[model samples]
Target: MSINPNQYKLSDRTARLTAQDLLPTTVSAGTETREFLQKVIDILLDYVKAVNDRNEKVLDFHHPEDMKRLLDLEVPDRGVTLQQLIEDCAVTLKYQVKTGHPHFFNQLSCGLDLISMAGEWLTATANTNMFTYEIAPVFILMENVVLTKMREIIGWNGGDSILAPGGSISNLYAFLAARHKMFPNFKEKGSSSLPSQLVMFTSDQSHYSVKSCASVCGLGTDNCVMVPSDDRGKMITKELERLIMERKKMGHIPFFVSATSGTTVLGAFDNLNEIADICQRHNCWMHVDAAWGGGLLLSRKYRYLRMAGVERADSVTWNPHKLMGALLQCSTIHFKEDGLLLSCNQMSAEYLFMTDKQYDIQYDTGDKVIQCGRHNDIFKLWLQWRSKGTEGFEQQQDRLMELAQYQVRRIKEQSDKFHLILEPECVNVSFWYIPKRLRGIPHDRQKEMELGKICPIIKGRMMQKGSLMVGYQPDDRRPNFFRSIISSAAVTEKDVDFMLDEIHRLGDDL
Candidate 1:
């Protein structure tokens, strides 16, 4: 009854083998696993190809109901095969607008860099929470190094920095830090600890995030003062001073002043030097919202255009995802003083940020942020900075400015066809395309009203055509105007020319 080694193994193994044993993962390995991954890679490659293809339409326009019908989106009781999953991905991409397209200018974030894309994929694979040095040690160090370099660029001798989810969260962090710096006990005691109502000031042209932050910080929206801006959209220094004095007289504690480095609609930069001086005179913390214009800091030629006296500010909110080619949601809020964020937002959860760790715990930054589980936003930015280098970034800044100038020049050349809002201070070129009926109407109030309606009409037509995309909005006195943002490094002079030509082509008959 002696069994041979090969025959014995085959008989035993065959009895144990089952269909479930061949399935993938916590289940088992299947032949289709690798094939499914390859299919995913193929779909991803096709997406990248479409994004880089200038001939490809930026968006495939469809209503929500239509999209629902086009995509057979339904949850199944059982899992489908790899082939069905691959088809689902393809269908999802079919309707998604290619934000990376060169002609897509509908949002502040509009470009993709291969280096950053690689970083994002790696970060996803890492799939680690940014809650402690134990989980994301490499990412924590990368974040520190990147933030230190950014602080140095801002001319800070020493400071602290944190990568927030977006510019809005960064702005919110600035508010929280400023509030805590002024009143350390406010966090524990709440806003009621203050004898006077807490108030903050920002230009009417500043992003709406300031008011949103104010409300989030227990300061009512009414406490966020909308300081008047000059005709060119820069904050009025005299008005700011007046408002501070008025708030003091009304017994409101004016503790924060936010200066805009680049306004949302107008792309205007507030007078940072004058604003800093006013903040000092009023004993208010200064925070600059450079979400859109901070990339100019890399450009020696244009840094002075907006970031002058930024080093004097108490804090800055900068978003690399906007103008610089970093992927979306890479925003950082920096403080001119060390330990401000820790004092403001730290809550030592016993489960995390333990005091008994063997390593130097100073490297752990999760305690310094309001979020416990943050995304690894720093890696993409760090990888981008490494690939592009400082000089590459400076060149990128210069090129965007040049392209914006080109857009303005072209708009001026066709004055009868397009009305320039004003000369752009940054890469935002805003103008209204004059339809055939509205041409040479002497720009009266009624004509302005009529032109306002034409914007949406033309925008809808452009959407239907699926040729180009640009943003449109109305300022206080101005009507809705097309704001073509040259934030994408992928865009060229040809694309700029194409944008103008497309606008004319779509709008001429409107």
Candidate 2:
């Protein structure tokens, strides 16, 4: 029995079919698959609608049995109805706590950008890796384009860049790149070959990532000197220079300097121009961790001169997720030289993925990255940038700054009940809640120092109210301050106004 030529006989197509079968059998957008997907989507939409409708009652969705069962998965199991998945998710949503909702102020993270969220869905579905030009051709090129655009904005004369998993890793890469620039031999010979006294510097106001970088790079966390900052949280440029000189005089290698465009506690911007000059003089690598304030790059209203010296730096860490509102894990570690990253991270995966280099063995992105299979995080960022364009982003940036200023004003207007402290560097407002009951405890440090132990008291009340969320903590650099991060594009004047009212109202009866 011969099959007709057009009848599509099964020749040994088993290889292709077998490969397809090996992958998790996800439904494609075929007739049946599309219906299943639609069902899933519809179920999710309804579930979201339900939560939105009865938001305050969402605690019921927090059942952990569903979680316990999901964790119990051992062998392959048949797929359940989309309804079952939706129900399980709804259970999770009970504790989900809507970050996108206007009320979610508890985190530096905030509401979703709809377009970016949809882009993330597309990225997940595609799930391409970001190593080289072969399999991830589109994403790799987009990475180059987006990073180059940022470089031009950062005032670079054609810098090289790579996408890191997060701002933290981006900071780590900056440290490594600076180390590579200073001691290129260190990569090949390890830290043992370098001066034992190598040290780096950051501001008292900078992110903890700098300290983490020191520990990770074998410089010892104690080796990372925290320079003092001015009252406004800007780096004390004089102190910084003195610290560098001190380290150098001790026969220690001062190889890197990190300036913050936006600090964690107060959103402080270190004097980048001044710090850059110091780094230039000391022959140290200058890295700007603009993970928070880099979003200000989109704004003519705020990019300010803080970013002025970024391009002069050996590297930068910019996370679009923080202020630009892209999905999480969308950060870039860019270098002034083209091959520095690859030089720092290259290994011979030659046994698996490389060629003699006489011809383009294109499908490899493994060399320049620390990760072997980095998920495609570029699409969401690229998609958001595309949809918003530079202008759209600038508008968003300007508006957020303006709203922040507005929030500050409203908070200050209540000088009696709430004490708003600190000028914003990237839209974080710091304050303290002094209820009438606690006011007698004396606002003096002698009494406040003891009260610091009972911080859980008011935080618990705030949590129960659920009217809004704000962050709290105490640091030695500054007294106990509640940090209010304005990261959501959805935040309006009403939301901030309500937040102030809630803080005061909660404190009043407490």
Candidate 3:
């Protein structure tokens, strides 16, 4: 039976206290607050149970206006009662899509690790900034330990690293650090002080953040040279060398090369060894954006997917949130050289980074980062790592890869009804759902165009059904194809089959 929060009338708890009791004073409201908190805890528990329940709908669909009316989302001058607040919380959960659901393959990130969630709650309770050890002593150390572990996994013995807001910020940090490495004086004199046009290289299949970093860092987006990729989406080493030579001939300074361990749409890994060799030849700083594929490092069986020449990279961006299933916004950027982070982005403030603190000032990491006050993103990941030992994480990663292979096999069995984009290099399985009408048709441009048009239409129907969630995107000229990723260990072979069956049921008519 549903616990109707409204049934708990005001006379039940708050009425026991007077107006003076409600007001902030020396008196403690522990009893009332504890009762309210217990109710809130019940709501959270219910939400968690629903997320794990396969019988529950992935999302309760509603149009914008309807959702607004259903939620009764309105800000009031006066605070709401605890009962109304609980009711609102329940309503909010009713509409939210359960990304933790086994069948959810909508994005690169989805999973609810209970241990990590507990850490997240504790982190919220602590509510400390990660800037200085003076404030966030435990979290600061946790960040250092986590980052060092990541660097060691990348084969770096000692280096500088910082956790940023996201992978995009991490990439930007690499871009800025590379720029500073090339022209040390640019920090004080600005980009105009540079001798030549600054240029960076990344594969055309690389994340758009690389190009965005170029534009944000004052290097024109045009200067962000995109090297061609092979059919598998790995950067072509020969083409990269040619681009470097052409840029050098044109008097442009090639300062950075970003090698993606996992491309977005296809989950392709660039040739890191080759990319590193070219970077060395061109005297450019090498960065590996392993945001999506970095978790593979934990797996002994699949670590080779991202291991080759990773140590050669001057910097690497890793996000534990993606494949490792840490909470959101857990991204780290590492540098080969010590103190480069401080040299590149530090803005020392005496108020924060005081020199005469009794404790060791080396822990005052805020000065070395772009953001002054950072969130405590390390604890959840740290706690998760502690809960799931190194070997346990490796098993988790291996299991995910196995699940991906299982999905591929299942898709291949229904070959006439599906078109495999390519053999997946990682956990991402890309394919198009060929409807009955299009299955027997000749593979041609017209057929591709028809498939593309039907993808979104079918997607709309799927959304209405709310049984499962998956993402679709066009890879270059190819039509919009479904990209299913396996990130959560919670997803089983049964869920994979359910997703496939749901897609077929939704798209077969088209």
Candidate 4:
């Protein structure tokens, strides 16, 4: 029984055997396994090419019931052949959204960096837990190096950091650290042991994760005070101070203040310098949630303008997966205090985090996080960084800004047909598409209300036509409007023009 996969045609081998024959310890399964993986890789490569092609649709949209009938999602009692599995992979890609598509402006996290994608494949192949250096030695060291460099970029001389699942978890970690640091006994004693009711503060325009963190941390949602934002969507420092004073007067302890570097809807950056000063005066832990805007820090031109005074923050949450265009699940939380995370999160699990390891136990970082089996998310980021040096990333940032400026310019060129919400300070270009019926109408409350109804109808047309995707949402101050994000490096001025043209084609009659 020759095990050489090439000896038999793929169709013949797949028809004869199932996945059980491809196990590592199975008799001479290496060649067959390699062949199977190669087939999957070939399918993935084709999908990647299709994603980059401008002619391809961003997605083949389907409702829940339709999707359930389209794909065979149920698990069967018997194992399927490798050939069926390969076909299944192809089928999955056929209906999935091409997030890396050139016209994908729906999310803050977009684009697929080839280097990072390769790194992700390698990490998946390694399949090792990031908890201990014993299993993921290279990745563990790479994480430290990447985190150290990130801290240096943030203008911190030295600090500790960890990659989290996403920006929300990163913010949660910051909240936990602040709470534990302020009241060391709170970790063991819970909220009952606290000296008083603990409260936190964030801008009304900030991510909803801040409020969620407060709820999860046992501080009621009402305890998370919402500071007022200015017309530009920035946190008003005076309002923040006033709220802190009000909370203090009520005998509640103000322990943490989260200043959003980039607000979600409007892309507004808070006044970091002013917020830092208020936090210092109020004796509050200053945390900056820079998950969406952190990539701008790579551009020296924008960093000083947008993220100035970030160094004064006690903690920061930055996600490379967003603006940096690394793969998803690459969020980092940095703390100015070196030992704060370990002191706050460590449970001293004797079995996993053994102190008697032959190697330096300090590298065993399992105990520093809430999860023991963390995914290896650092390799993709580190590899992407290596491929694109700091200057390359700066250029990428500058390009994105240039594209956003071009979009704003195009929007202004057709002012009669489009209404700009506000001039964007970041890559988020928000505006409204005015139908021919609404064109030349007075911009009043009634007109605004009528215009707000246009987005969802046009969005539905876009989906049904399989043209492009741009997200729409109603903010605190405004109704539904198109909020286009320019995160992918692949997006060009031509794509922007097409987006506007597509919207016109879809909504001009409405």
Candidate 5:
């Protein structure tokens, strides 16, 4: 069984080899495998550079059917050559959205942090599950430290936390924790065992995940009451109190109240202090969905202004991926009370959570989560935090806020061309770009209807042109309008101006 390393030389033979010839199979093909990986890395690095280049297109637009034809997406019965695989990687990046682009103000999660990227690559190379300290010892410790730091930033003296897959799952964790805390019996007997029908409240402008959590947690969507928001998209505190009273009078148990720190479209921070006062009086769990706005906690200036009463929250869901510029899917849910997560979610699978372990079995955190196998998402955030420190993150938040303000001011200055939706509290600047045909029209239902049509058309044009990528949506009261976000710290004031100028260029002719 002696193998000759000379046989795996970097010749035409090695170039023709497939992934099957690599490690864990043909160990002698180490050189060939390294060569192939190097090629792939070059492609990725080039893509990273291109995405950061403002002149480059945010994405190469392709229809679903067209994309399918463009790329060899099918899992073949046979593997392709090493060179073909490298080409495939390049092609995949070619058509994918450049979320890191400065002009790519499409979503809450955007940015390319080199430090975090390196951590993510290292995490993948490690390829270990974050179930137990024995398995992911370093990562488990890192998660604890990072989560502790985040809890401290939230003004919590001490707390428990877990990194979930995404903000949605993190929010779901909050929901589950609240439910278990309120009705511990519901765990064994199900929702049917509850004393009464449970109702949760969230602002109408809050992330839809709140309602989704309600549905998934067996609380029923109908019971998830939507508290109305004001013209500024903040939860009307008086209306919230009124709704809670009405729900109680109807004999439903008000168990959880989710106040959004930063709404999806409008980026409005709710009156957390007022909401906290109400939650205390009503004995409801106050969970702040700071998934989008949580990065503000790092800012000395905006933290008090935006998230004043976040410290009073019983639990909080914060996604570093959104504003902190961590890689996608870095979300954490923290609880003020310790052991609640374990008591609420632990199944104590004997095989995984053994009592006979020599080490402190308390570090075996697998039982504390709903999922058995969790990905190591903490490394990127931990590494990024190490590189940036709290002050770096604060500067990033302040810069994003400044860019948002610059965008708002630009919109107001060009009021003839664009209509500001509302004064943004976070980094979301919502507005309507008035095309030539719609300009100077009297503000009415007819004008609003016409304005709605502009966003879809301009969006299509921008995609076709491959110049920019911004999100557009219609709210309950307002018609379709651009909901530009400034999540990426890489985005600049110049980019903000480019966004406005490009919107005008694309939509000026109606």
Candidate 6:
């Protein structure tokens, strides 16, 4: 009788769930359905129970074609049954599952915190918003609390914060807030009222997001002056000061200076103390893009002197998803000055949010943020924090740093194989696959440039094998180094070792 009678139906969920005419009017959760669900629960429970067991045959379930097929957006409704979906997940989607797999040294953030994943399931089911206190009181309060914790770590006393989608948007919020503090007239009349001569400075080694912000802010990408970097990719403070003085002498109003902490390619933290002094002297807004290093702010012993002068900056962007291993889309932009974000993106929504100014009108995030109907991304992170506690995240950070050190130590002890490109700064250890093709080369500029070409050849072989994955990028004129981000709490030394072995094996073939 249609497999089962009672099912998950639409009329219950207006916003997210709806009925489909092409398919069954309702999904079954009847007696048969209960039996099916019990079986499904048994399977999922087994998987979770076997989380630490990596030698299982379930790892080899999905072939290349099966994975390629799964990427397709649309297919016949009910074409993939719940049983089939479970089988595929247990088989086809093996490596992608973050079980701290020994060889899965691929992405920036890896490792499944049991708590984080559990929170994710709850959050997806709840599906709330962070726009107003009347709606999401708990999450809204948590956002403020978490942001305040970050601000306190940054040494700010009474600063404000707003959560954003990612690090890119977090940096954008900082820029917008700074712009509001500096040039409020632009909000009233747009870029026409502001000086096109307004310039910003970030290192040649800094993120592309800085230049992207320039593009979005109408300052033009050309205005994002790439200050020279040292061999280690940290921006030269003196050189930055020189550039600022030169820009000022040339009558360019230097508005912002973007200093990076644990940069993408090398995990290099710029001299924030020195940079902050320059920004303070020139009355320019300083923004520390600490998306990569912000997690370490929780690690008192190891946060380093990286963000020493952070409190002096006008704003800072710290993304928990990248470092804290909260789920994706958990980032925040904090400011020393209060209400700048509200003042920047605020619009008089007379038909909706505004008009009743007598009430607590400061009760909206849509105006302070670039997105309306922003997903309630806070709960996954807040619940994770609640479950794990701040101390757990701090220990996770310490463990990652320790893991990064282990990678460096293992690579450095070897003289001729993998080059420990830079010492483990934060959680990144960039290195290269020193293939036999470029081995024992003459110490000349020509050979140095030739070393740059070896990475892509080796990387191509790695991908073709379809076994392991680690991102590679050339940064600050260094020979292309494989950038290893130990952002995953699931990763261990064994994974790093396997990653190195894979790189070596692939490079030897090349």
| lDDT for each candidate structure | 0.86, 0.73, 0.86, 0.91, 0.90, 0.72
Give, for candidate 3, the lowest lDDT window spanning 10 residues: 1-10
Residue 443 in candidate 5, Cα distance off native in Å: 2.7
Query: What is the C-alpha local distance difference test score of candidate 1?
Result: 0.86
Q: Pick the candidate with the highest lDDT.
A: 4
Clashing pairs in 3: none
Predicted structure 5: lDDT:
0.90
lDDT measured at residue 378 in model 2 versus the true structure, 0 to 100 = 82
Can you give the lDDT of residue 280 in candidate 4?
86
lDDT of 5 by residue, 310-355 (tens): 9999999999999999998799999999999999999989999998
User: Considering TM-score, which of the candidate structures 5 and 6 is the better prediction for this target?
Assistant: 5
List the candidates ranked by TM-score, beginning with the highest: 4, 5, 3, 1, 2, 6
Candidate 3 steric clashes: 0
lDDT of 4 by residue, 440-464 (tens): 8889878878888989999998988
Two-way lDDT contest, 1 vs 6, winner: 1
TM-scores of all predicted structures:
0.94, 0.86, 0.96, 0.97, 0.97, 0.85
Which regions of candidate 5 are displaced past 4 Å?
Answer: 1-11
Model 2 misplaced regions, further than 4 Å: 1-32, 46-83, 351-353, 356-364, 438-443, 446-455, 477-479
Better of 3 and 6 by lDDT: 3
TM-score of candidate 1 relative to the true fold:
0.94
Q: Please write out the lDDT profile of model 2 over residues 1-510, one tens digit for every residue.
A: 111112221223221232123224634424434443554455445444543442442122223676565442333356543434434444444455666666566666676777788888888888777766667777877777888898878777776887888888889888887788778898878867786689999988789988999887788998999999887788899999999999888999998899988888788887788887898888998898888888887787677644665666777888888888897768887787777887888886865466765436533657877777788888888999999999999998888888889988887777666666676767888777666666656457764554454345566666665556677888775456677878888888987887788777766755
In model 5, how large is the Cα lDDT of residue 395? 92
Local error of candidate 5 at residue 488 (angstroms): 0.9
Query: What's every prediction's RMSD, in angstroms?
Result: 7.6, 8.1, 2.1, 3.6, 4.4, 5.6
Regions of candidate 4 where Cα sits further than 4 Å from its true position: 1-9
